[model samples]
Target: MISASAAVLRAGDRPYAIEEVILDEPGADQIVVQVAATGFCHSDAVARAPKFVQVWPLITGHEAAGVVERVGSEVSGIEVGDHVVLTFAYCGTCSQCADNHPAYCETFVQRNILGLLATGGARATAAGDESVGARWFGQSTFATRTVVDARSAVVVDRDLPLDVLAPLGCGIITGAGTVLNVLDVRPGTSVAIFGVGSVGLAALLAAKAAGAESIIAVDLHPARLELATELGATATILGGDNDSVAEQIRKLTNQGTHYSIDTTGVPEVILCALGSMRARGVCASVGIQTGDVVLDGHALSGKQLVSVIEGDADPRTLIPHLIQLWRDGRFPFDRMLERFPFTAINEAEKASLEGRAVKPVLVMS
Candidate 1:
């Protein structure tokens, strides 16, 4: 057994104080990780909201980087002290995995969303033997130490800083993969990205790398728009005013953008982006939005629209490619990060929601 400090959400709307939690040793097909850093994503907030009552007292977090401190006997290719990134868990025997699409594995909802350990039980607990649900996205990495399935951990270069690379697990991969893999963006393609957060900025960078002729970035924050331009957006649209945003996008792309991606998850922004697409143009929605999306059937039929999960990428392949791009200095994802100590997780979350920080990484001692 090991003791670690973890941020626990015990039936509250927000994450409360960090408490000492107990972690068990790795079992078969499992590995113990000493977390170096974890990215504070907005999705963590959504998961804690009332909408997600399925899992309670869950240790929340997904994007993370760490070092393998111990490995189960059944695990292979990974060893102690190996640097790694913890990705969303998947049951490799599912049909989706058989087809080489683990991201869409049918068991993803069970393995990752439900926070079940590989042993099919809880991996963490409080002092009184009460469950402090772990295994969220297979890592529950809000804590200083995590035990995860060996399959969920991807070994990365030890030379890279964990804080800087942690975001690559989710947000970064979702955005970049949507453009490079899902859309298969090519030279001369006209693309418009709605919501210039970490994800949208990643799409912009990928589009530029693919030689897109025009890259349009739509966002309310002037600072984000400026960053979008610096990252590779050919044009910027202030989306605060809904009516004019589409018009400005149309003006920049002439008839309309050939490919449009919505990362904001705002209903209005999704609709605007759909309307901004040329006839039969592809529109990919990568944002996490709840509630019903109301849209005209005929409008959607006229323009092809599709939703992508994990940017339609296999993390094993896409993450390495993104890291290579970063090494080449073509993808400056580090510029989007704002680091904070793990103790200040609440502050980091607030900063992200208030637009004060584009992306926040919580460093663990």
Candidate 2:
């Protein structure tokens, strides 16, 4: 086992506490990643909920970018010292994984969300061998070091800064993927995105890349709406200004948009996005919702609801595409980042929760 510094969440409603712990060595198919940076995704906050997470002292950040320090005996197609971005876990043998949709893997919840390794044991231990739930999303990346199966990562360009690329693993991918992959927004098409958070903003940017003519952004924050416009939203709607956000969207786009994405996960906000869709339109949801989405049956009049996780992305292929887009100046996701040292994680979390930062990257180096 290797000693490492990590931010531990002992309770859902409390801040993470930095502590020293013992990280177990990589199993046969795992690799030890020396974390350079990791993004604080909203999903990490899910691990703090007592109703959702059963593990104690869990480490939950998943969007990690780092270097391979050591490889397990069964590892292949990866090597030591390679730059990489960590992603969600998947069981490679599942039908979804075999068909290139690993995000929907049958064992996804068990391997990633349950905070348990496939073999059913904790991977980290504190003094006196107290267990710490460390493998959240197969990464637990808010640490100096982590062990992951080879399938949970994508090798990235060595020259690019890991901090800037980390969000590609989850937030950026989910948003952009919903646009480019799931919705496939085409030129001259119209789209409405509710919630101009990291995911929504990424969707807006992807809509621009897809040549969407009427890209609308809806959010409560004026600052976020302004940023959305700067990032390529054709129109911005102040969520609270309108009597009905869905009506405003329909009026703006001439009888609703062809595509809509909701990143807020609020039931009311999702209803608005759903209502703002054209015939046979698609609405993709990427937010974390605690309550059931109670929707009326009449709302789906030829409209499709896509409850997607990870934007239906296979990280291995999508990460590189996003990186290339970044290099080509098409995807400027880095503009939404606020960098902080690893020690100041609580401050970063507060910034993210308070909407002061769209994407907060914790630099571990």
Most lDDT-accurate candidate: 2
Candidate 1 overall lDDT versus native: 0.85
- The lDDT values for all models are 0.85, 0.87
TM-score of each: 0.95, 0.96
Give the per-residue lDDT digits (tens) of candidate 1, residues 1-365.
Answer: 86789998887565557989997666788888899999987777777666563666878889999998889889998999999988888787889987878889888777777765356435688778867778778778899999888887888888998899999888888899999988898899899999998899889888988899999999989999999988888899888776688788877788788899999888888888888877878899999864567887655757877888888778888888989899999889998999999999989888998998999999997
Tell me the tens digit of each residue's lDDT in model 2 across 1-365.
67789998888888888889898777788888899999999888767666787678788899989999988888898999999999998988889999999989998888889876454324788777888888898889989998888888799879999989888899999998889889989999999999988999889888998899999999999999999989998888899633488888999988899999988888777778889988899999888764677778778799998888899999989889989998999999999999999999999998998999999999996
CA shift of 361, model 1, Å: 0.3
- Model 2 TM-score (2 dp): 0.96
Per-residue lDDT, model 2, residue 136, is 91
Candidate 1 similarity to native, TM-score: 0.95
Worst 10 residues of 1 by lDDT: 114-123
Best by TM-score: 2
Off by over 4 Å in 1: none
